[model samples]
Every structure is written in C-alpha cells, then in structure tokens.
Target: MSLKSLIQGQKPLTISIISFLLMLALVIVIGLFGGRHIIGYLEGQLVAHGIDHNQEVIAGMQPILERGLQDGAAVSVIVSNFQSFIEHAEPFGIRLFLVDRKAGRVLADSQNRAAFPYPLNQLLDSMPRQLNGAPIHDLANWDGNAWRRTASGSVELISLHDLVVPANREERWALGVSSDLSELLVLMDSLHLHLDVVLLITYGLIGLLGFLVLRWVGRRYEAGLEQQVAERTRELEQAQERLIDQARLATIGQTASVLAHEMRNPLASIKLALSGVSRSEGLADREKQRVDLVLGEVDRLEGMLSQTLDYVRPVVRDEQPVVLDDLLDKVLGLEEELLSEKKLRLVRSKCPQCPPLRMDREKMQQVLLNLLKNAQEASPDGGEIQVSLEADDKKLVLTITNQGPAPAQEVLDRACDFFFTTKARGTGLGLGLVKRVVEEHGGSVQLGSASGKVLVTIVLPTAD
Candidate 1:
C-alpha cells in the first residue's frame, strides 16, 4: 500500500506506537555511534598505558650499556651482561633483544641467541655506522610500538627504544622489546561484547516506557474525537425531527383551511336565524334561555375556527424599533385581570441595560401574552409566576417560570409541536403560534422543568 493508505488503515494507538518506535530506533542508532566512539577511545588509552611497560624494559638495560661502553668494553661483553636481566624477565613472557647497527646483526636476544642480517625496520640501514662518522640521529630515548602478528599466528607487541652510549663510539644500537598480548586481547573482546549487551537491554527498557506513554495519549485523543462525533450525530437527529414536524404541520394546515372555509358560511346563517328568533315577542323565557345557549355554543365554534385560521396564516412582519420594557408592561397590564382571578403573583425582573430591539411589535406582544397565559394556566392557585428578561452581546433572553407540576420529559420534548398539549380543553395552538413568531424573528424556544417549576425560555436575536 501507499504510505498514506498505510497510515489511514491504522488506528490511532497503532500509529502512535509505530511513531514512537521509530523515534526509539533513532535514539538507539545515536547510542550505538556514541558507544562505539567511547569504546575506541577507551581501547586506545588502555593500549597506550600498556605500551609503557615496553619503555621500562629499555630503561633498565640503559645503565648496563652505559657502564660497559664507558669502559670501552667489547660488544660481546655487553651482550653477556644482558643474560641475568633477560632471565629474570623470562617468566613474565617478555622478549628482550639488542640490534647493533655497525655489524648489521642482532647482537643478542633474551634467549642468548644471535642472528645476523636481522630483517626488522630498526636493524638494517644502507649507510655505514662506522669509519664514516655516520649520523646517529635516531631517537635517544624511546620509539613508539605497535601490535604485530607473528608467523605462528600469535599476537605480539614490537616496541623499539634508542640507546645513549659512550660518545665517539663507532657503533649505533637500538633496543627491542616484544611481548605476547593474547590474554589482554581476549579480555578486551569480552568487554566489548558486554557493552553491546548492556546497550541492547537499556534500549529495550526505554522503548517499553515510551510505548506506554504513547498509548495513553492515543486513548485520550480517540475519546475526544468520539465525543465530538456523538454530539454531531445528536444535532443531526434533532434537525431531522424539525423537518418532519414542518412537513406534518403543512399537511394539517391545508386540511384545516378547507374545513374552516366550508364551515364559516353555514355558521353565519345559523347565527342570523337564532338572533331573529330570540327577538320574537312569542318566544318563552325558557325557550329564550336555550336559544342563548345555542348562540353561545355557535360563537365558541366560530372562535375556534378563527384560532385555527390564525395558526395557518404565515407571519407578515412589520419591522419597527420598539422599547422592550414598555411593550412588556403593556401586555402584562392587559393580562392583570386573569392573574387576579387566580390569585397568582406575577414577579417581574429585567436588566437595566437591555436596549431597545428592532422587531415586529404586534408579534412580540403576541409571543409574550401567549407565554404569560401558559404560565398562568400552569401555576398553582396563589403560586408565584416569575418572568425575567436578560440580554447579552447578540440576543435578548426571556424566561417565564411558574410554580407548577413539572411536565414529563416527553412533554417537554414535544411541547412546541402543533396540536401537542397537556390540558383538557386546550387547542394547542397558542404556544405553537408563539414558537412560530419567535422563530420567524430569528430566535429559538427552550422548554424545561427545574425544581418542580415549569420554565419556558425564548432567545431572540438582537440583530436587525
């Protein structure tokens, strides 16, 4: 798969784990480079310190040569004197030798053996060291040493040292020291292997710790995203419900419009005949009372038709700048008679800085009156009815709360739906009209119950 597809197919946790592993891999690579650098430096320091032993052998032999050369002793005498020193060092795996530049020979080795034509770097020189005053400019203290493998496949060290003998001598000599390093080499190999193991274990432990932390981060990230998706899903469901409600109401409005049109003319004729009969002189008192009752029922039917028609009608706005507090007080004054009949108390609160709003004045009054009427119906006898008006940057919020039995959850959910009501005689269009008007003016309605009180909240946009 392509890299993008590969990443898309993985869960957040797996992706995070892989990413952390890559980071850990990079860290391991850096550690490997650093470890090797440290080991190389350590090995150099150890070998250089070990090579100091080679110089010690040369220093010990210097004095014996100095004494013999100052006495004008033969080269054979110097060679014979090296026997005791070489024998003492034999147990330590040391090989001591001397190379005489004048004769092109190994004068004597640690084993008291001499070999002519020594094929080493120090022993052979083209220029004569005698009879020509040959310059002996080779170092007078010590030369550097190196690791070398012998013909027998054993590792050894070849350390060379320069000699300072009696002046005016017709010979130049260099000291040679060799030692077996197989045991030290084996120890160093083991140490390097141990270091590699330590690095591997340390990296494993660090990677495990990083993996756990990344897992936690991935979980939180996944949970947050899931919550957002759930919320969006709820919003979509709510929108679907709204569309369904609108479609149902549209179908109902069309049927009501037809029925109301047919019923109005027949009701008008019945009311005219009843009025004419009630004014007749021959009409009895009992007959007149029954006729009045019939007329009253007819009027009620007509009023119901008007209400239905009102709900069916679309809102036609008359935009104006209306003082919100004044309009509110006027509506409340009109409803004072109803409030008094039930002995219900109306408590009013408004923010001081709530500015004048641009909206349909008649519609605003209708919205407020419908809500007040609902509150009055829900409030217990002599219970408190609270109305509050608050404002913020972009909207005006109005809340109406009554001390009434809280409605059921289902009721609250469908309270604004057309023909949805809880009252016995309710036509269910009052709050429905209120909702339509408020929404038409760019607002929303919220119904809730809190502390056994029925609360209706309206949020109206302040923008023109």
Candidate 2:
C-alpha cells in the first residue's frame, strides 16, 4: 500500500509507532556518517604523527653514519654498528638503510648484510631529484619474510639523499628509515569498535525519547478531535429535534381543527338536553338532582376537550421584544399561590447580560407555565425547584430542575410525544405544546432525569 493509505488505515497509537521506526532509521544514518568522519580524522592524525617519527629516526641515524665515514670505516662495519643499535632500541620494528647515490646500490643495511646491493635501482628510480636537503616520506606494506621474518605490516619510509664530504673523501649517500605503522592501524580499529558501541547507544536513546513524545502528541490530538466530533453531533441532534417538532406541530394543527369542529356540535346538543330535563315539572327532585350532576360532568368534559384543542391550534405569534428576566418574574408571580400551597422552595438564577429577545409573549408565557406546573406536580411537599437562565454570544439557555423521583427512562424518552404522559389524569399535551412553541421560536427543548430529579432545558437562538 502507499504510505498515505498505510497511515490512514492505522490508529493514532499505531501511527506513533511508525514514526518511531522512521526515527530509528534516521538515527542509524547519522551514526554511520559520524563514525566514518571520526575514524577518518583519527587515521589522518596517526599518519601525520608516524611521518614525523620517521623523519626523526632519519635525523638520529645520519649522525652515526657521518661519524663512521669520517673514521674511514668499511660499509660492513657501519652496517654492523647499525645492527647493534637496532638490537638495543626500544622500538624494534624500525629499519635503516644506507645507499651509494651515484651507483644506486645499497652500501649498508640494518636488516640484512646478505641483502647488500638489494635493488636500490628501483628505490632510486622512483626518488625525486634535488631533495632540497629534506627527507621524502612514503607508506608501503611488506611481507614478514622480506624483513627479519618477524611480522607483516605497513611502514612509513623516509628517504634522504645528500652530498656528504668526510675528511679526505667525497661521497653521496642516501639514508632511508622505515617506521612500522601497524600500531596506529590497531588503534584506529579499536577506536572504530568503541565508537560503534557508543553510537548505537546514543541513537537508541534518542529514538526512544522521540517515540514517547510522538505518542503523547498523538493522544492529545486524538482527544481534541473526538471532543470536536461530539460537540458537532450534539448540535446536529438539536437541529433535527427542532425540525421534528415543527412537523409535529403542523400535523396536530390540521388534525385538531377537524376533530374539534365535529365534537362541538355533539357537546352543544348534550348541554341542551341536560338543561331541558332539569326544568321539567314531571320529574321528581331526586331525578332533577341527578340531571344537575350529569350537566356538571358534561361541562367538565367540555373544558378538557377545549383545552386539548387549544393546545393543537396553530400558533399565531405576536412577536415583540421582551426582557427574559421580567418575563420569568411575571410567570412566577402568577403561580405564587400554587407554589405556596405545595411549600416548594423556588430558587432563581438569571444572567444579567441577557439581552431582550423577540418572541410571542402569550405563547412563551404558556410554555413557561406548563413546565413550572409539571415541576410542581412532580416535586414533593417542601422540595426545592431551581430555575436558571444563562446566555452566551449565540444562544440563551434556560433550565428548570426539581428535586423529585426521576421519571422512568421510557417516559423521558417520549416526553415530547403528543398524548404521552405518566400522570393518570394528564392529557399528555402539555410538554408537546411546549416543544412546539419553543421550536417555532427557533429553539430546542430537552427533558432528562438524573440524581432523583427532573431537568428541563431550553435553548433558544439569540436575536441576530
């Protein structure tokens, strides 16, 4: 799969893990480059130091050769003396050679007397003319058998060719010194091994720390996205609820108008019959009293029917600017007696910053009264009821809470459904009407139960 597809298919934690692996690869690359640079730098220093040591050896051996030549000693005697010096030296791997410059032949060798005349022709053939009285250095590797059969390794070779005039003699000699560089190579190898271990540890630690940081940032990002999704879902649900409420209101309006028109005629005929019977002289007093009771029952039924029809009637809004706090005060004053009878404590919290809102005053009053009455009925005597109004830049929120036995989950779920109620005598249209009125005003209503209390929340958009 492509990288984008792989990443998209993974969870947040899995993405973090992938980032850690990439970081490890980066660390490996950095470690390799760093190790190579460090080893190269060390090898350069070792080679430079070896060249300087080889030049010093050439200087030290030149004086010995000059003294032997001034004394008229044979080349063999000089070679034997050099051999003796090499045997007593601390660094035994050094080799010295003395050669005749004109004839290009070895005159004395510290490594072997039998190797005299040992192909100085090749050594001189490659040497530069006009040495400027300074030594020339080069590096070469040799097999162990060629030298003293001791070891095979590389060496720094320093060659000096100059005209030397001993007393009563003029001769040209080329002096050469070979310094073993095996120890320097060994040191480089050791440094490389140690560097490898150190770089491995350093990269490992860095990779681990990077992984942890990525994991933390990934979790935080995931949490923020989740919160945003939840908030958006809530807003969409509120919008859907408002649409449903509007549709329900329209359906109820059409149905109730027809039903009420039909029921009114029958209710009027029943009232006329009861009135005629009560006035009849042929009837006994007990019968007349019975007619009176029937008339009272008819009036009660008529009142309930009228209320239901009124609830379903299409809302005619007389929109005006009204202060929310003032509106609440007026509604609470109207319910003073009922609240006092139940001994219910009323707590009010209002936001001072709430602006005037445009809505139908009479309809809004009805909505508030219905909700308060429900709260009062559900609350026990001496229970507390809380009413709070809060506002933000976009909306106004009102909440009414009453301390009481919570309603069943099923009842809460269908609280806004027409003719759905928990009370035995309730018509179940109160909350449905409230929901319709609120939705008509571009608002939403939510009913919930928690902690043995009923909560009703209303959210209304602020005036643009």
Candidate 3:
C-alpha cells in the first residue's frame, strides 16, 4: 500500500498509535539511563566521604600508637588512648581495637573488651604495611548496602564526619572505618523509584494524548471510510465468490449432520447382521472365512459412520477426569479392523507416572481416532504406528508418528483449518474436529513433517 493510502485508509488512528509507541520507548530508555547515573554518582560520593573519615581516625591515633610502641607502655595506658579516641569519635560510629599481630589476639578494644575475631575478607588494610612505609592516603572497600570498610580498622559513617582528619604524612597507624553506605544507596534507590514513577506518569499522559488525537482523527475519517465501503461492497462480493469456488465443501459441514442421522440406522443394522452371521456355524470352512471378512468390513463401515455422526453433532463437554490408557483402548477398538486391513501395528509406550487428565472422553477419543486413522492412512502398507506418552512438570504429552512420504509444506500449512483437506473424498472435518476438541480441553495439537515421516503431537494438562 502507498504511504498516503496507509495513513488515510480505514483508521486514521494509526498516526497517534505510532507516535505513542515511540514516546513510550523514549521514556523507558531515559529512566533506565538516568537511574544508573544517579546511583553511580551517589556511590562515588559515599566512597569519597568514607575515605576522608578513615584518614582522620588514623591521624589522631598515629602519635599515641607510635609513643606506646616506642616507650613500651603497658596495655592499660594504650587502651586509655583507645577509649579516648572512641569517646571522641562516638558520633561517627567508629570503633577501635588493638591486635597482637603475632598471636592474632585482641589486646585492647574501644568497647572495653577483646575485639571479636576479625573476618579476613572484611579487613581493609594491614597496619604494618601502612606504618612501615610512607603514610597512606584514603582507601576503602564497598561491603554493599550501608557497610563499607575503610583503611583504618574502625566502623563509622557520614554521621561521624566531624571525626574525619585531614591526610597527614606523620600518621603511623592504619584505620578501618565501617561506614554506613546506606545514605548513598537510599538516595540512589529514591532516585530510581522517582524515575520509575515519572516514566509511568509520562506513559499515562502520552496514552491519554494519543487517545484524544486518535478520537479526533477518527471522527474526521469515519464518514469517508463508510462511504467507500458502501460503494465497493459489490466488488468485494464478486472477489469472495471467485475465491471460494468449491460449492460442495461450503455445504459439507452443514450437510454431514443432516445425512448422518439418516445413515446411522442402516450402518448399525449391517454391523449387527454381520456379527450374527459370523457367530453362526458355517456350512464350510471357506464360507466361515468369508463371513468373518464381511463382519470386519461391516465393523469398518460402522466406524466411519461413528466418525461422521460425531463430526455432524459435536458435543460440548462438562469436563471430567479420564484415564488416558482406557480412553485410548476404546478408540483403538473402533480402529481395529482398519489397522488389521492395512497390516499396521499400534505400539504404545506410555509412562506409568502419567496421571489421568480432565477432558470430554467422547471428544478426546474421537481426536485420537482421527489422528490414528490419518497416521494409518499415511504410513506405508504394513508399516508400524507408534503412540508414545510422557509428562513434564505441567502437562501430559502424546505423540503419534508414522513412516511415510511427508506431506507437502503448502498442504501442511492449512491442515488443521476448517474445510482444508488432502484426500479426494475427505470431509476435512476430522482434523478440524481434533483441533477444536483439543483446544476446548485446554490442550494444543501440532503436526510436523520431518525425515520422511509425519508426526502428530497432542499436549494436555495433567489431572488435578
């Protein structure tokens, strides 16, 4: 279609729809990018603040620590300085502890008891490395959320900004401050939530504007489209008439039901008569054999009649649990003569764990019968037909595969659609019925052709 026609034909609302989608995408992209940058900036600030606070704690304790080491002061005097440091830095949430490096034991802690065993991964920096070398500047590690460890072995946060000391070369001790990074994270989180809210509001406004624009555009275009459709109605009817030229198919579904009721009584009588003849003692062995053959053919006719009736008069289900194996057996009984005539074998490898499923038994059996009959017809004369069942976390599956020349792709595409059939005398309602019944049972049916074989798969939800 030309761009002008596409814009003006049928619905003028297309313009607003396209514009709204573009604006919605833009809003999402902006929110995502904005949230990321806001979080990054907040993290950077938190890291900077954490590093500065550690520098102060290290500076204050440096002179006292060095004097204690040089003068060989008792642990009591060293701990006094530690307590003073903590008292001064209390607002910052800084805690200090002295460790015996060789023994890995705490000597004096700001809390008036031995420090808890340090977690190696949580350790930020080694005191020996800081003191034995040039004075260290700021260093910190993010412990995620509000927990951040600094160069000095202390825990603190932005609330303790006053305890931060300027970096000094004279400092000899290392400091670890566990800063509360929550303020930064909280700020970042707030920004993200705000951005999300803004995006939602933007989408709502855009949708409202687009709806108004479309309504206005539609009001302007509706009269013109109605006039055009009225003018071209005759031409469209001619095209449809040419397209669906098969008159017989157009009436098959409707006529099948009407003819079925009339045909069933004679089919049943023929089946019953053959059954009685087959049971009677034959005058000769050859006669008996012919009688059995007649009985078999009668059974096949009866089955065909059943399929027609089922198709013509479909029954909507009040679904109930059906034992799959039992249902399959009943369907197989209906198809036994056809299977025998073709010398086709039916093999079942059903998982023992497969539970019963909720379905319309008659409809489900009809589906199975249709699928198997199709398989039987498709296979090479005397070939095998395999029916396998398995279950997953949610659904039970059944697959029927037959060896034959796979169907052409073009024919396969519309195989399940109503009135689409491949056979010369086919009613086309068989697979269509199968599709409808499976769908009504909350299941799906699939047909695939591969490796010179046709496969039909039916997936049904497991029983409650």
Candidate 4:
C-alpha cells in the first residue's frame, strides 16, 4: 500500500508495548539502585553505632581514674565505685574487669564472679592490636556460653579497658574493664527484622503490580491482534472478490472478442460502400466529411474493444529486478501528453537511494497509469497530482495522490473490481486491471481518501 494509506491504517499495539516495557524497565532500574542505597545506609549506621558505644564505655572510666590519681585513693576503692556506676548506667549488659597493670587480677565484674568465671590471660591475648593502647572491642566476638545462666541470649558487642595506676615515675599497673553489649545486638536484630519485612512487602507489591500491568497489556495485545486479524481477513476477502471479478471480465472479454471479430468485416465493407456512393453522387465536401466521421466512430469502437480485451487478460508476472524510479519515469513519459491535455500538474519525488524490486515492469506501469488517470479525472482543471517513491531497508513503496472530494464508501469498496464505474462513458475496467497487475507481482494495491485528497499506493518487497 502507499505510505499515507499504511500510516492511516496502522494499529496501536506496537506503541503500547514499547510504552509498557519502558515503564517496567524504569521500575526495575530504580529498585536495583534503591536496594543498593538501602544496604549501604544500613551498614553505615551499624558501623557508626559500634564506634559510638565503644567511645561511651571508655569515657565512663575517666572519672574513676581521676579519683585514684588526684586524690590518692586506693585502686580497689576506684574499682568498687566503677562497678556501682555500671550496674545503674543502662539496661544493656555491661562487664567491668579492673586488673593491675600486670594484667593479673580482676577487681570488679558486671556478671556475678561467684556464678561465672573468666580467664584473664585468654581475654587479654585476643585484644585487637589496632586499638591505639586502649583495649580492643568487637560486636561479634562476645561469648555468653561461659556464663549461660547470667548471659542474655543474643549476639553482642564486648568492650575491654585497662585501669592504669602509677607504680613509679615512669611505670604503672594496668587493670581491665569489659562491657557486654547484648542490648545493642537485640536492637540490631529488631532493625534487621523490620527491614526484611518492609523489603518483602515492597517486593510483593511490586510483583503484584507487575502482574496486573502485564495482564492488562496481554488483554490489550490480544484485542488488537484480533482486530488486526479481522481487518486483514476483510482485505483478503476483498482481494478474492477482485480475483473473481477478473475471471468474469475474462469471460466477457472473450465474448466481446468473438463479437468484434464478426462485426469488423461487415462494418469495413459498409464504410467502403458508403464512400463509393458519396464519391459518385455529387456529394459536397461537408457531406463527404460526415461520411468519414462515421468511419472514425467505427474505428474508435474497435479500439475501445481492443483495450477492453487487454484489461481482461491476466497480467504476466515478470521476475526480473526493476528499478522503481526508472519504472515510474517511464510511466510518466507515457502519460505526459494525457496530463497536459487535461491541464493537470504533476509533481514527482524519489528517495536518494531506492532499492530495486522483482516485478513486471509493464504491469507496474499499467497500475501507475490507471492511478494517474483516476487522479486526473478526480481533480478539477489545474489541479495537482503528486507522485513519490519511498524505500526502507526491506520494502519499496510508491504513492500517487490527488486533491478531490472523497469517493463514497460504496464506490471506494467496489472500485477495484471488474466493470464498476461512476463516470458516464467510462469502461470501468481500469482499477480492476491495476489490481490484477499488482497482485501478480506479489505486491499490494490500496486506495483511500484523506484530508480532502484521494491516494493510491503500491507496496513491493525489496532485496534491500
């Protein structure tokens, strides 16, 4: 079909599918990046809290040390005060181990030492070396199994600190204090659970939304497919009807051929007899000219008969490659005189690089001529006819258009069938012949009205 006709008849499914896929892709991309952001934020919060809690524990020990150094209080007394401070500080599990600078003794404990015991050397050796002279701490390294009865059931952080006392001007005794972090571990667990639940719900909603959207898309796609199939089926039926009409025309043409053959000899003999009588009888010049006009009418009728027969004969499909631009130029050459006689203006354009198609050159020419003639007839004096060729990677398309009133639906429907016409003296086989020739070339012919113009298009497969 022609470019304008094909564009006007396009379905909306392709555009709809592209829009839906873009929406889905956008959501997927957002979810991927958003998930990364969420995970990064959670990890950052955990690390920040770990540092904060460790700092709080170390800072709490400063008051106890000030009393021992400035007031010259006993180490044992400072240790007892520090123990009382931890027991009431917060609900979090806290351990305090105050040992001498030699790391040999525990002065105070958060867990009841009577119930659970801790090995001093084992704890000190495990301290992280990166701690800048302060004791090491880790949230994941706490052990509750040693004091199962007193231990809260959770993974936790453990903080350790050593109490330093001056033994001389340069040396001091080192003591240890450790804090248990079962409560923060519990908070972390709760935060993780909340995040997981939110993620699950969000993903579920997204999945449900995607399913509904796809279902809606699927329904729309099916409806469009059905509509397209119905439309194509109707066109196929129309094509079949045209084929049947061509068969009938072939039948009529055969009959007319026989009748013409029988009448031509008698008509020629009568013309010769009339001429002889006019020459012998004192006929005036005007009377002789009138006799000659009668002969001309007979010849015109004979020519019309021959044209009708040619229309009925099925077009021979030519399989050779044809350059469509050259073919269009050839058709234009044949119709130039006719166009000039009608005073119709013709405008032509071609793509920069049009592909060749395998088609019958004669048939294509005939189709173009028939469409151009229709355009010329439809338009008023000095009306314009436009012709163009457009090619893509796979198909070559031709269009011919003329400004005119739209044809009635009934006329448009039957215009490409044999022997259908609206003109007073038209033979009415023009469009039918065009249809036969186009189909024989394995292309399609289409006709339509748009924007106060009538358009005809031909589409042929190309080798690209």
Would you list the clashing residue pairs of candidate 1?
none
Ranked by TM-score from best down, the candidates are 1, 2, 4, 3
Error of 4 at 42 (Å): 44
Deviating ranges (above 4 Å) for candidate 1: 1-146, 149-194, 256-318, 380-384, 392-395, 436-444, 448-453, 461-464
lDDT, candidate 3, 272-351, per-residue tens? 88678767774477887887888776666566655655654544654666778778878888898999998988788868
- What TM-score does prediction 1 earn? 0.65
For 1-464, candidate 2 gives per-residue lDDT tens digits of 99889879998767777778888989988998999999988877775665677677776777877888878987678767866776554357766666676565676666654656665644432332221333233212211111111225443334443425475764566666655666767778898998988898889888898788777777788899899999999999978976776677667776667767877788789989989989999999999999999988788667767667767665675556888789899999999899999999999998899988888887788899999999999999999999999996689999999999988888888998878888777778889889878987889999998888899999988864
lDDT digits (tens) for residues 1-464 of candidate 4? 89768655766556455555666566656665676577667655764565566557666775667556666776556666767776664465555554443434344556544422233443433433332334435312332112111233433344444444445423243333344445655665676666656665676577668767776888888999999999999999988976777678768888778867887788778877876866766888888888888877777777667667767666655666778888778888988998898788999998769867666676677777778778888988888999999985577788899988999878888898677899887777789778777766677788888899888888877742
Q: Name the candidate, 2 or 4, with the larger lDDT value.
A: 2
**Which stretches in model 4 have alpha-carbon errors above 4 Å?**
1-243, 264-289, 292-296
RMSD after CA superposition, every candidate: 8.3, 8.1, 23.8, 13.4
**lDDT to native, each model:** 0.77, 0.75, 0.65, 0.66
Q: After superposition, how far is residue 64 of candidate 4 from its true place, in Å?
A: 61
Those runs of model 2 whose alpha carbons end farther than 4 Å from true positions after fitting are 1-37, 48-98, 107-151, 157-177, 208-320, 333-355, 358-360, 376-406, 417-419, 424-429, 433-464
Give the range of the ten consecutive residues with the poorest summed lDDT in model 4. Answer: 142-151
Using all chains and alpha carbons, the TM-scores for the candidates as numbered come to: 0.65, 0.59, 0.39, 0.46
Identify the leading candidate in terms of TM-score.
Answer: 1
**Model 2 TM-score (2 dp):** 0.59
Name the better of 2 and 3 by lDDT: 2
Question: How many Å off is the CA of 287 in candidate 4?
Answer: 3.7
